[model samples]
Target: MTESVMPTYGRLDVAFTRGEGVWLYDEQGEAYLDALSGIAVCNLGHCHPAVSRAIAEQAQILMHTSNVYQVPLQSLLATKLTELSGMSQAFFCNSGAEANETAIKIARKYGHSKGIDKPVIIVMDGSFHGRTMATLTATGNPKVHAGFEPLVPGFVRVPYNDIDALRMAVSHWPEAVAVMLEPVQGEGGVKVPAAEYLDEVRTLCTQRKLLMMLDEVQTGIGRTGEWFAFQHAENSLPDVLMLAKGLGNGMPIGACLISGAAVDLLEPGNHGSTFGGNPLACRAALAVINTIETNSLLAHVTLMNQQIVAAFEHALSGAEGVQFRSKGFMFGIELPIACTELVKQALAKKVLINVTADKVVRLLPPLIMSADEANKMVNIVSELVLAFLATQPKASVA
Candidate 1:
């Protein structure tokens, strides 16, 4: 904890020196089971050999050359992503925020193309987009907007998972250009919408001609048992699809993929990124995609999800004021009371976990996690949760 770095984050009193598949080692070389996976950035786990080797080889040969020059790796990466996502084109950047910023620009420009002077993108309440000014404004949490006043305009929000509210908002706003949201609201407490919600949204967007944009930064790249979360819905394809987190498997890269209405919205001068889709980053991303496909981790995630969910259900069946929900490796076990302290508690027990939206203990373990690791995580979390509940009054627990 040095004063040299900005104290923007309320960081825990621990630092890791290195990490492996699903484990991180501190200064003392103590191994800790990693369930968070760097907040879903390391879907293939830390320092995956394939991604690491690709990065190393590319760094040795050619790390970067301006986007002005044709980068073959970028084209290859885009081809693989398009093949997997059914999207037409991709614009790459450095993180999830930039990818989303690209989507917002496309929405506004798309609106302009349709003769709407001011475009509005429909966002959802309780959603977490990013920390950039525009993304923070797009985010649904007021805490994210407390100090950033006079927030970016032309964005409206409705309750998540409420299709009727979305319809009303869209109908009310004549200048609406697109609808942006996560398939599973990850930072919004792992809230999974109704099974057919995406299908319904696709229908509405098609009927209204609104560009359906999905911010799949957290739920994409096989985290949701599919290449992309939107793929879970039948015949549902987004006009704009944003991705980052797991795409590079730890390498910093973000992408905005376009299809249908969103294609060609941003012409040559509309937008660009300096380091976006560089040789090194794109190579790493390609390796990540290849590794995932080769390992068959998507199906593995489905199996492990079922296993982990059943294990928790059986373990906490008798517990009151507890709720468990999951989609793939994204697990949320919510308790009645706020348990933010459980992060340090789990850390003390040599495990990593995260808490979001106050009471929802979020677990995003590496997709490469084995059954033993999964069981270990569930046991530690369940024991800690039950113990925390025991200290509270039975009435308070609920």
Candidate 2:
């Protein structure tokens, strides 16, 4: 209610007081099916018992200590991340933006170590990196850069899934150090590239001697029914992987993973964070990972993803004015007409969803969502889309 609190986000009217599993309760106790899951942050579902217990226990012991000393939990988390990702090392940070910033620094440092000045990174169109100055400049959407002037240099943009364009850019700019992208473009309307696009990109990066960096901020930690979306594709493992969103299951921890030649770019005193890799955050992340493994949430995610996709296809596919694109729990349904208003309509029906790129209805439910909850989500949104389409003018039908 105060203008001084920074008016960056378009605030929703409802205020959630508590969340459990796949449901959120507002102040007045109205229950809404949480399909967005805080934009894919609560992958294990809200208030997970294991995560809550870990945070409580950790809070009683240690909360914050500067990264100037040895932290056992941090080391343990790094080891777990490396073993899972096949990367050599990890640098912990606070958010996706900071992780991306670290990745940028690593790429440039890798190039500088090779005696190259002014390194450039190849980014993809419709990709959402983050909101920091450098990461915002790296983002493909121009709207995010509207007020930010003098954007950071050293980024080359190319169309998503277009290998020829990448080749031309590489040929034109020999100083390019890395190619950064999202396995599934989350904020860019859940766009999934061609299955072979990542494989081709990996080959191109290898041939050109560039780092393959993946911004898995939204697609990692079982959001895509795998530890990382790159695992879903063949030979698409990245040299550098940026992780954040669900790493701590809403506790705000991030990491940048480096492998091969890019691992040793950051030496002692080169880069550090005051609050990064703190004991409490690492403990929280450890709990999230442990819970996912102990409960087999990855398999649950895969099963629920299949059920949700099948339900969507059964209800909306060929329903005269609907189309869908999805991978695992991440999905986007494109109505025949712009459905920006459907967000409010779905909320009115006690369902929560988001609209991105104007026409795509995006749904990113928790990985623990059951078959019943998944079908409810599909039915609610499908009915909203169908009802919305009926009101469109016939002349506007494409």
Candidate 3:
């Protein structure tokens, strides 16, 4: 077959034709239990009726009108998002990268406003922001920055979950304007920081008057058992919050929200996206928010997170060198050895999963996943891990 698409991604051989709830169907009509939710993009599952209908209805009525005119749906979505996030304003874009880029711009501009000629936004080690030049430079992964040198300046690096390191960094760099990071470090092997980490960071940022930016691209939209991951921390509201992944439940949409110290940073003509916040996208996002609210999916996720984590703990209790962690539907199991092959093994079992950071099996099942489906996914994945471990040479436990 002649391949026209760019080989940017090392895609799997199988192609899915359709999806519903937590199940995906291949071209041959085989079912694969989806545990990754399109890398946490489809929170409500594939083809959710509300979101699909909203897109369809809006497509028939309007899809794009450019950012020159007022987009009512965009305004409505912004209002709803602000109400939910406690943010003062919202800027929309087409992907997580753009949202983070918007955030980076805000940080730099805010720094410039303070008369800092060169500004620096502190980022964390092992964090993944986006693929754009600025965002990829902001990201802490070497692989993302390998081929893109002469990288954008003004981003400093620090260790994740270390408040003292952040404090030291802030003190060392007097021109630092903001601290940007993920709540759970999604692509960083689902690393969850100390419970007080966010609160402490918030306090430090407040004391220093620096923007506390959170990249919730993979943790927002109820993925972390909260409306936003920052909500999990007591009184931790970021100056800048970026979201995308599950915002529109598979639709392409990203938002950079602002509050104190970060508001009004980007003036008109400073930044704009032609397709951002168009009617179709905003309509779908509205439906997603409405559906989540109506279904009480947030509470459901909280409960399900408890249940699934307990299940994983019990299933892998005696497994050597295995550690499990989760926040809401974001699950990670770190094995003793490199287990990238487990992705292919799970696919053979008609279960879809992802391996990040070489050893962590990252699972992001849909929020609408049924208890039965959840149990099935757990069983399949647990069995696969056990079988794979049994084949490997046993290592001594500490």
Best by TM-score: 1
State candidate 1's TM-score: 0.99
lDDT of 3 by residue, 303-333 (tens): 9988899888999998889999999999999
| Candidates 1 and 2 compared by lDDT, better number | 1
Question: What are the runs in model 3 whose C-alpha is more than 4 Å off?
Answer: 395-398
For residue 296, give model 2's deviation from the true position in Å. Answer: 1.3
What lDDT tens digits, residue by residue, belong to model 1 across residues 113-173? 9999999999999998999988999999999999989899999999999999999998999
Model 2 residue 86 distance off true place after TM-score fit, in angstroms? 0.5
* Candidate 2 local lDDT, 153-192, one digit each (tens): 9999999889999999999998999999999998888899
Residue 180 error, candidate 1, Å:
0.4
Off by over 4 Å in 1: none
Considering TM-score, where higher is better, how would the candidates rank from best to worst? Answer: 1, 3, 2
lDDT, each prediction: 0.94, 0.90, 0.94
Estimate candidate 2's RMSD in Å: 1.1
